[model samples]
Target: MNDKRKKLFLLDIDGTVALGSELLPGAADFLQTVKENGGIFCFLTNNSSKAASDYVEQFRDWGIE
Candidate 1:
């Protein structure tokens, strides 16, 4: 593996970040640590009923970026 290579983490929202409106423990810390270690991440969801902005708002509500 290339240690210099940048990493990208595609994280799921439901059950991963939260179980409804609540943010799971260590979720924010994990993401922040990844960022501090020079990693990038994005939130993914299977539900297409809501737009991307909706997810952004949800994250904001959870105090996640």
Candidate 2:
């Protein structure tokens, strides 16, 4: 474990992770991979038009944790 390292990923939800209201291709898989590799991530959005629960449901719809 000498090469153990920490990684933190900050991802935007609007365009990077999703488009309009749909999750982009591979976005879910990418997040899953990061978790599998012991990496941390935070998903954010500048738009406040939607509620936090909406985002959670969106992620759930996209099959992402």
- Which candidate has the top score in TM-score? 2
Candidate 1 per-residue lDDT over residues 10-38, each given as its tens digit:
88989997877788999989988888998
RMSD of each: 2.2, 1.8
Q: For model 2, give the 10-residue run with minimal summed lDDT.
A: 1-10
Q: State the lDDT of candidate 2 residue by residue for 1-65, as single tens digits.
A: 57666589998898899998888898888888889998989988889999989999888887776
Q: Single out the weakest 10-residue window by summed lDDT for candidate 1.
A: 1-10
- The segments of candidate 2 whose C-alpha lies over 4 angstroms from its true place after superposition are 1-6
Task: List TM-scores for all candidates, in order.
Answer: 0.82, 0.85
What TM-score should be assigned to candidate 1? 0.82
- What is residue 31's positional error in candidate 2, in angstroms? 0.6
